[model samples]
Target: MGFADYPFTSRYQTIDGHRLHYIDEGQGPTLLFLHGNPTSSYLWRNVIKPLRDRYRCVAPDLIGFGRSDKPELDYRFLTHYHYIREFVAALDLKDVTLVLHDWGGPIGFRLAQQEPRRVARLCFMETFPFTFDWEEFPLAARPLFFAFRRQRLSYWLLQRHNLFVDLVLRLSTFRPLPRSVMAAYRAPFPDARSRYPIRVFPGELPINDRDTEAHRAIEEIERGLAGMPQPMLLLHFHPGAVLGRSRVAWLAQRLPDLEVVDGGRGLHYVPEDRPERIAEALEDWLRRRLPEPVRGALPAARVAAEDDRFGGALTWTFADTEHGGMVAAWSSHGLVMLSFAEDVDDGRAQLARRFPKASLEAADQGAIANLLAAPAATPLHLVGTPFQRAVWRALLEIPPGQTRHYGELAHALRSQARAVGSAVGSNRIALLVPCHRVVPRAGGLGGYHWGVARKKALLAAEGVKEP
Candidate 1:
């Protein structure tokens, strides 16, 4: 869907009682676009319209920017993190492909680490997750910060008395933004009152040692980014404030797998200046990195458990007295069988007989097992083909906290919507694998091998909006 064609939506959520504004468009592999300081989802306007044909694009204004409510909230790292977590939870997006820039680096990186298996890949530009190690600020950046600190001075200096947006557009691009495009960027904050976020953003930068709290979060994000094995593609602009050969080299040394794109002589806003190149890079990376399709049967001993956390205790018992806690058995290679038993120990013994070499571990901090013991959620193992496995891996990329529909999944898989449904039904490690988050094309709860009621409960508990 085109930018204009997609309507903006708002929802009143309990988190801070803020009305979060977001745009959800198209169908396919989810592309979560996150904006940084002084800008909103509108920064993605030029890029999203082109990529939406092949991917679902969901972009939201950070709590204090764009059409979202700007309350007297603490504008700290943790606060932004909470909003982002709630935003995705409310929508129930999964298997997410994150597109980050500037401040988005830390925000999106934290979310990825929170649920590593849920993120498929990452694409970021002009961003840094490091702290204390940042290169010296550029001379041009100095003026910007100067303007930022002298809020009163900047207010009168800029003819319109709103230099934040003007500076963003001017310094953001190597080439001047088109007149119309520049106008659109400034449209969100028409007056000084609406520009509080912009005025306060620079002061939020953790530039020195005294800014401990924000710097600590930055350090945490840097450590997480360093350890992430997920494919990361960095699109960097040359000769920009945040981009340079030395910084690029540093990142390369840190994230050896990271791919860096040097937009020769381009400005910080690489997405706007080189949209097609960015799109091509993303498409190529996805094709090369996505795992090859493999057909297989669900292992019999592997049970599907659902809960808020994966490492929790079992909440229900599928085994009887004879086979305690053992719900299914599977061949080492593929096929598995499901059995209901009265005895938990007998179930374990039965599963051991089926696959002596298979290991058992609680999923997601014992959350799944806890849910299984209480029967508070659905538990089922899915069996399917190699094509289905590829489909399942794609499903895992949805960020821990987001959801998508069957049609969107199909588009991401480059298959028919019906085929996507069939594959989704075959998922075996539900909750841990997160197939429960995928819904129907009409935005309703879809089928679940365990039961539809369980699916609804899980989605509702996760804060997903249901039709």
Candidate 2:
């Protein structure tokens, strides 16, 4: 499809004296699409067109790519991060749903973390922000790595021979890209000299803590994500035969709220193969995360009456009532504060302490108890930092019967196994949310809030065939 035929309205904005190219279309809630290395807003062409009518889609070509200006400034993390912040500010976007892929993860993630209230949800695909050890890099990337480190030599070769754009397009995909797509990607690099950022990107990958330029920026972004509570969706692509699926699984475990979708192309560029899926996932998440308008306010008495029913043992009695489910109750008060006891007296005392002034009474709310006793079909709400939220959201997407290791979830969350485990442990609503489904790398039952026995029982109940 030709670029002109697309439904988007093209425009440019001046951010910090540089002209930045962007596409805005549709008219409902706002959706910001951030591009990764060697690609521009054009990467989201397919996504924008389909979603325009229902959403206001804004995809910006990072400062150096597409129609944006290629200034002679250092193309470091801070520079890009500042440019994105300026671009969003210039446009005055609010309550945005961010779609990030590849390097877009850090760029978009930083923006969300900086202004958490403005970002309702996030959709991450085939990207990482935590850390990627060089040992995990694919064999094909070794040459690219070596070329990047030899900055002077690499720049000379890429710019002199006009190989940067061509090589990127060629190696970015497992399947061959069409002539038109190739043209679109390479169109920005009219000459080798204009491809400085392309050369700089690979060189900037933090191989160690010594690379303070990019490493510190990434670490800061990781810290931000660890605490963000916005809902996150993780698209776990196949890393490659060498990396294995375990890495992605590790990410899911650490991120208590992640909703991982399968069938992505690979680590290099998932956007090229599954742009629509990523866009749709973002759309759905936006709908869920953004608060809806209350339809006609209820009278205080009515609200109080309802609260009263849910106040004490009365809450147990209404367990099966319209809004009296245990999950619903915990969802409102937060899981950390809710308590359950073996005896009625103990439970009553706990409830009194938990909700001091709220009335306390008891009734047999069997249905709510049953619901909690059963495996959850509804996904759990994982509360944590933005990165942890992203990781947890990815975890939620792991199919009900399937299990992934801590390391696999880490790779998907773009963090480490240890970080993933910490997030998993932070998961509030346990059984109903299914944090129990996550296991260890060695195929043993990992830790669970309720207990390992309960975790195993829940997993078995969900039809997980124990090995």
Candidate 3:
């Protein structure tokens, strides 16, 4: 039900006698992310992580998808739409900005058309607003999808073998996905019955009026789009499956306040290939086009309360160290914060900066000493973006007395050196996270939070020779 990369609180709502799972994080204007078939809320994990800091990001595992309950109902287009509408109603989510992908495009657009005022904006990718003709579809993908339309064949491929989770997803992305990520996508559909929803989804594709109900639904959504006045963002990419260049142009002509951005190199699964790019584009759009909603949606007091929900009561103390005085803070969860400082007062001040929302209390001096003595063994209550957490996890893998350059760490994470360096800079638990082990690839020690001298000293103590 959970993955390390998707480190968010799981929330559920009872909708039509079924339990629908979702991840609701941060506060302010709502960003309701709707996923498509063969994927779930897990698809938006990386995309949601950074945006959650500024926006109320809510992504639900649609009924029969991800961790949601799989009722034996007809998993049809209207069925999904009905459940999503009810789910939104249960949460009383108003002034929502829809983030749509794949089948989510049609479902979300229908919601906006039906309840235009409730939805403030729309952002979508790899999703189409209308049904497609056979000729319009990607040539290479047509045969596979055509076969999926056959009930018996689709059952065997999608249900028994799990084709989408196993093969299609890997092919749809520009780069190969990590094994852990693929595992998360496969976790929900472990058996034939569990994958029924996935099998039904392909059949629901409204191609050339084949699926009358879905076709009509999509046409209705399309016809009403030009009249809808919400601001929209279209993240288009090359070699698209559902939404190609022509579709982007079609959307631009319809959406009055549309802002289109090239979401970099990606295929059907844009989120997997370029989550950072997608997040940056969406964030920029929000900041520039809808600053009022982004900043002024929630009351200041309410915002503070929601943000401080974690690390409720942090106990902190100063631990004397050879290099300098060290500050340490811990919550019931684990060690929350640790840093190098000048003195006891300086240590306390540093802890205040780290855990501003936390109600600070004096911890046992002995416990703080024990933590300093063996920090690697202490469990860390690390707070960071998924990318930052990934980098920190890799950092922990580096043995003591060893060092890795920024490029090497970046290569391991399948990220750029600059991005990895940014994550390294944001490390909270200093010595334990081992950011000091990361040096400049060219030669010498790079920048450190405490000081270069302190970094060199820490590295030397770990038996790492200065380059």
Candidate 4:
């Protein structure tokens, strides 16, 4: 709805002669988010935004939904499954963390079963993990679901009035959506003709043990549930549409390695209702269970000769800026260290300790002042462990006028706040790496090596107002 909220680049892939729209953001381990009927990739915007800086988040619009082309197919369960299977193959994604909801559960579960090695873990909300007998379905939802199966009436309501987007969607959410959000969901199915897939979705539900193709397909997919144990997480809420209390209990009994968290209050559209809860749960679970592989340790020979790699006399200089007095140093490679210092002699001693192997020389103060003014312009000879280097790189991505919570940065990096704080504290490059932009999530300016006052002053200079 609002580009400010869902600000991600749209991408496309041609699969099965149709242009399938998707959003692929960030880089690292993959988090492939799949949406059910009515909702599209837009369903995951808020969830994706917080995690994208650390993990690669990919959400695709199904062939007949959202920005994807609407081909005139039967839009049956298997048909949608086949398209999604092809879509995954086309992308060649590996070791994926599948985040599914509603119909997405069936599609993603089937894919995971077919290729277990490719899928790393699974997290779902209000998903269809098994076939539902009429009694198993939520009592409140039965009437509308029954109406959806009554061929002619379903067509009249779903297609003619677009009831799925209008009535059903509105009623499903615990909270009322803004007009603009409703419009975004409505944008996909503009007319009756374009609503064919929406009309077909209801009939695809495997209900009442009926002798139908959908039931048979779901039966086959359900058969693999007990065995598909890849660290599953169930983010359930009170009185969800199909995934109610009884059904959740049934699922817990079947799915192994299962961890359940109450996602506060929500209805069918939990993403819209509790996106922050979803994001936090997912970030915590993923960090604990599927931690990113640590970069390999360097060989002994290389570690011994680390200083020789950047062999040359390092130069140092000091500058008095509006914020405070600053000490800056540069090696032949680039700016090696920069920090705010009250005492010039003590700062010099600290610099020597940081680079004990290199010879220190005096440099022009003007050159160091210009580098401080435009930090990004100068190259940096960052010396730290692989993880610390990663934290430094993440620090550079923070926009000048913005600040990130330590926990937020930690989650983004799939690490704990203490670990992130250690990495941030170790940063020697100061303004060039922008470690001062990090703050405590609980609302306070966190500790700064230079001083909290200097951090405040630096932020104020960049137009960032602290809460």
What TM-score does candidate 2 get on C-alpha atoms?
A: 0.62
Scored by lDDT, the top model is: 3
Q: TM-score of the candidate numbered 1?
A: 0.63
Q: For each candidate in the order shown, give its overall lDDT on alpha carbons.
A: 0.63, 0.64, 0.80, 0.80
Task: Please provide the root mean square deviation of candidate 2 (C-alpha atoms, Å).
Answer: 10.4
State how far residue 164 of model 4 sits from its true place (Å).
Answer: 0.5
| TM, every model | 0.63, 0.62, 0.62, 0.63
Locate the minimum summed-lDDT window of 10 residues in model 3.
293-302
Number of residue pairs clashing in candidate 1, backbone atoms closer than 3 angstroms, sequence gap of 3 or more or interchain: 67
What are the RMSD figures for all models against the true structure? 14.8, 10.4, 16.4, 15.3
lDDT tens digits, residue span 1-467, model 3: 23339888999999978999999999876899999988999999889988998999999998999999999989999899999999999998866889999989899999988976467678999998887788888888888888888978998988999998898888998878889898899999999999999988888887884856878888888888876656678898887777778778887777655678888788998888888888999998776444221111222211121112444788888877666678888766567668887888998877666666678889887876787677656876655433455667788888999999998976765445776787789887888788999999899999998899999999999999997
Residue 272 alpha-carbon offset, candidate 2, angstroms = 1.6
What would the per-residue lDDT of candidate 2 be over residues 317-376, giving only the tens digit for each residue? 223322222222233322222222444555555545444545534444564555555534
Off by over 4 Å in 2: 1-7, 239-244, 297-467
